[model samples]
Target: MEAQVINIMTYEVIGSKDKAVAVIAYGVKTPKKLAKNIMKTHKNIKSVLQKTGERTGVYRIHPCKLLAGNKNTEVIHKENGFSIKVDPQKVYFSVREAEERQHIANMVKSGEKILIMFSGANPFGIAIKKKHSDVYITSVEINPAAVAYANKNNKLNKINRVRNICADIRHAKLEKFDRIIMPLPETAISFLDAAYHFAKKGANIHVYTFNRSFNEAARDVADTCHMFNIKCHKVGEHKVLPYGPGIYKFRIDLKV
Candidate 1:
């Protein structure tokens, strides 16, 4: 029998022992020290945070996870493009979202601007700029380390089309964007107002949400549009990301 295709993931090897494995969802990586710092920060966020022994050289990381343990841990590396500085333990899941973000980038023409809210390490911006040379992209991230990582990624990728903004989206003075991307499904619903406020009159908004059915998701988008006083329609339906067994998160695009 062939090996089963498990969930998409990213992993890294760390430490002299090579005993420690840093895994990420969909094959992402972060610096070892940064990974350790993330663990420390996780401890500050929750009292029940478990201490995993630190190792050097390699580790796995899952990026899309809001929390650590619930994160996708399985990771493998294929010879596409991989980074070693970003330890796998601290960052992983963004490849699919990166693809979506790249799609948006291709849609951009010269002089077009885009805003990405909840931009973790500015992955969306990176994708956009990487694909579209003439786009001006702005990325906002709340976490300081993530902001740093985003800046580093921009430098690493040698992309000049993005501006990494380090601030909470609620307070950022955002200009109108030709397109907008918010991949944070769990937290994005609450920020529809912000999305509306910064969105251009006819901007394409891509949102991720957890809805049991397509109708539910459509209704959810409708409700959010109504609240924002904007007309909305579904542009497309992408893959349903697996949160766990039987639980799925859908990425739905809306043109508003």
Candidate 2:
């Protein structure tokens, strides 16, 4: 038996070994066929969803429609050494950022205070706490649902030091942090001033941005620092993922 490929399957799976859910990107031309293929290939994946629209607004969540099997979207996505109970429809998350989160975790030093902006389901916070139990973490997110999930995930991971703040980063009242992580690639650059506001001297801010090239990403960071009247240096740059055609999401580390 042979079946022609309707379109290249661009999808990601969430959950652990027992059961999982598949999410297909919005650009997939034949999502149903792709969902069928995903279900066939991954026996553990019991539910499939396809994106109905691009990620819009500040929430970074898009509408999703069930394409196959059960309609459940909530799943305990386990990675590294922690588990996060999240509903993809209710919050923004990316299984593809697993390694990126790990890298950010590895950058942390013990007994340091860290802040994460646009924390979503607090995946980066979990990753850091799992690796270094001595560090204190604070996560700020605007979406109430995501903040709820972030708290639940903290308890699920048995992590006790994370403080979840439900508000815009600009309005968040907090002390200075030794390190900061900004995962919102769409408009992270615009929030550099906020990051600087809560940053201690000699702090490192890991900012993720999408641009045509790494140089352009670094330039944007430099320009933002200049615009904010903050003294900073570009310490590192990393390609996190491919966002679109000829566009890459880069992590530009700013040392203040």
Candidate 3:
């Protein structure tokens, strides 16, 4: 007999394969029933979860309700030839940002000292190590849970040369780096001065932000640079994702 299927349009699969497939059925009126139906129809999916809250707090983790199959929330997410173990309920992990992480990694030159701010689960640092093995990276995150998972992921991926630090970037006594990455688009600009302070002369800083238009994104970067008295030139601007109806998450690469 064929198992029942839920409407694909009403839900999204957040992660998959060799583990439980996490699905968010926020738009579905009968989420639990839909989740159970998904688990019954999809053989590869061992579990189904409904997202319970918006991602919030310093860790950016969202609460989830298990509707079917196993109770485990921890799972291995394989991407870019690496295995990353993360518990969505404990720490933030976005499959959507995987490509953006790799893009940043591709921009790095060999032997550069790099700092990744808000390096959640070390995906950014690990992607860089996988692409460019010679570079030294310091991955800083405020959430202890994220830091632990990041270290675990680094070991799982056999990635070396990345130093994971669990502390607020503003309070961490960090050495100047050749390239600084600010990945938190919502508030990356607020930390621009800290990035400038920790960057060596002629360093490249990649700052991500959210704005309604490309012009506004560029202006935000330029205004932040002016506030820091740093000479900033836009190397490139990329629209990472559509944040809302008219707003977008953008990355503005700047040279100082």
Candidate 4:
């Protein structure tokens, strides 16, 4: 039997796979008419949620209100396939994303040449470049289409210091970067070799990983580095995503 259509007041579009979209939250037993109405009002949201091998999904439409008294704030565009909105969502999260944004800004001031692997739309790099003028950034994205959209977003945001490279990050031959950022934990573990090559000795690397235990996940990374005779110390850890009760997505800062 076909499941009854439900109106989800909160939803996200995920770009980690083909047809990246998802309805994250809604009241139980919602009616089809309500779901239909939501789709009608938010015409850009695609229904299918695509999952990449990393098991991470991408959201096409991200909504948040940065102002007071604003009924809704929806970030919608044509770059990816999504248009659903989550009301009352924080427009700017003051979490790890905020910290990473701050760190990017700091690096720009020190004239650090940065490379972002798995940069989807390169929002993290773009935010820093906008605030700091001295830094040069090269963002590598695996998806050609996503790279295109990142370029468009750069233009839309009036940012010019960012260079978008569309290629498989794991095999791309590029200069060593002073700082490297990998935000996607699902596949980040497999891309450590890429990070090692692109990162200069004693460079700062921010990596994401997925594991049932945070310590175990971090230990796996440390072990991976040790095998290569590369000494790495975990400088910090944060819960960037909630996968489950104990299994969570973690971001670890390492100094090589």
Candidate 5:
């Protein structure tokens, strides 16, 4: 008899010695025996969880159901020579965005203050600070759970100077930053006003948007800048990742 198809998740491994957590897509039928078979074949997977719904509420991560193995969703995800303790069930993280984070870190100059908005798990801060130790970094996020993990991740990497705050970034009083990074793709474009207020003259700002085309994403930023009365010229653009069929997450780099 032919075995039923098992949609083995391609989630990135979370720890050394090949430990991983797999999230089964919503509506996928994963039988118990099949889930066991997955663990047998993919020995590295420490657990299996099912995606239940879209990200909503304060958690801002996919609500998942534990299907097999350990119930603990927390794991230490190693990336770019640093480690991040995260729970996919509690906070949003893109395993594929490590390269993008590193690219952002590469542009940081020493002594420049950096602001990372929607800074979930403080991943971008880790990549940037680990690479450029002299620069000051501050992360503002809304979710308390993510902020807790962000603080732990900072200490996990022995990064002592980062300021992690748990509050809506719009209401947070902050100093102007020399470089600003907005990585929250789903709604980051809508927060350009916040970036504008936090930016220093001639400072760099990076915005990520999800749109049908790269041109549309770039145009959106230009229009937002015009509305905000800020002369944020586009200095760079990049296709960070594909959001869906014909939809992409693009990063637009600007100079204030």
Candidate 6:
């Protein structure tokens, strides 16, 4: 029997693993019906979830509604040959940013001590450690759930070099690192001073920001570096993802 063809224009799969698929429906009148249609079309998709709201708060969590199949929210997300157990409703895990994570990992030097601010689920740190086993990483996050999962993921991934800390980055007493990563795009600029204070001389800092253009992002980075008295040379600029219609999430890599 031939399978029915459902229009895919209304929804797109944001994430998927094993038997589950998470989707964001747009211009669809009956999302539940669409979910059922999605399950009918895709045999591997046993669970279908609809993302309801924007990712918000320090934890960067989004609300999800189960439209079909299993009710479990937790799933094992695999990327770059590593496994991460994430509950999308509880913590921030952007499957979209997997490539960006790898890009950052590729830039790490041997024996470098790295600090990851807002290390939700520890993907960035894990990715870095997986790429460079000689490097040590310190992951700081405010959310307890994210921290717990970070620890779990670290064990699951068998990454011993990453130290997952459950504390706000502003108050955490941290040692200097050879590299600092700020993944929180919307407010990463606000934490530049802290990142600068914790960075070793001749270190690299990768800051993600949402802005209208790369020039705007560079200007912001340059201004922040000037304020901190850190002589920053822009190593690279990359458009990580589209934040909205006009704004984009950009990564500005700097050598201090």
lDDT of each: 0.58, 0.88, 0.82, 0.57, 0.82, 0.81
Please list all clashing residue pairs in model 4, or write none if there are none. Answer: 13-58, 13-59, 13-60, 14-57, 14-58, 14-59, 15-58, 45-83
Candidate 6 pairs with clashing backbones? none
lDDT at residue 173 of model 1 (Cα atoms): 89
| Pick by TM-score: 2 or 3, better one | 2
Model 2 per-residue lDDT tens digits across residues 1-256: 0111223347778786667888887878888998898889877788999889889778898789999988877888878768988888899988778889889999999999999999998999999999999999999999999999999998898988899999999999999999999999989999999999999999999999999998899899898889999888989999998888999999999899
The TM-scores of all predictions, comma-separated, are: 0.67, 0.93, 0.92, 0.67, 0.91, 0.90
Better of 5 and 6 by lDDT: 5
Indicate which candidate wins on TM-score: 2
TM-score for model 6? 0.90
Indicate the TM-score of model 4.
Answer: 0.67
Question: In model 2, where do residues sit more than 4 Å from their true spots?
Answer: 1-9
RMSD of 4: 9.7
Candidate 3's residue-wise lDDT over 150-254, tens digit each? 999889988788999999999999999999999888789999999999989889999999899999999988988898887768888899987667999999998
lDDT of 4 by residue, 1-256 (tens): 1111233233343222222223333332433443354445544433422111222233222332121112333233222221211121322111124445555455454677889887766667666676666777898877665676677667766667789898878667789888889877766766776788888888888888878777888898888787766666888776665665578877788887
Which has the better lDDT: candidate 1, or candidate 6?
Answer: 6
What is the C-alpha local distance difference test score of candidate 5? 0.82
Task: TM-score for candidate 5, please give it.
Answer: 0.91
Number of the top lDDT candidate: 2
lDDT of 1 by residue, 101-130 (tens): 546566666777788887766656666666
72 Cα displacement, candidate 6 (Å): 1.4
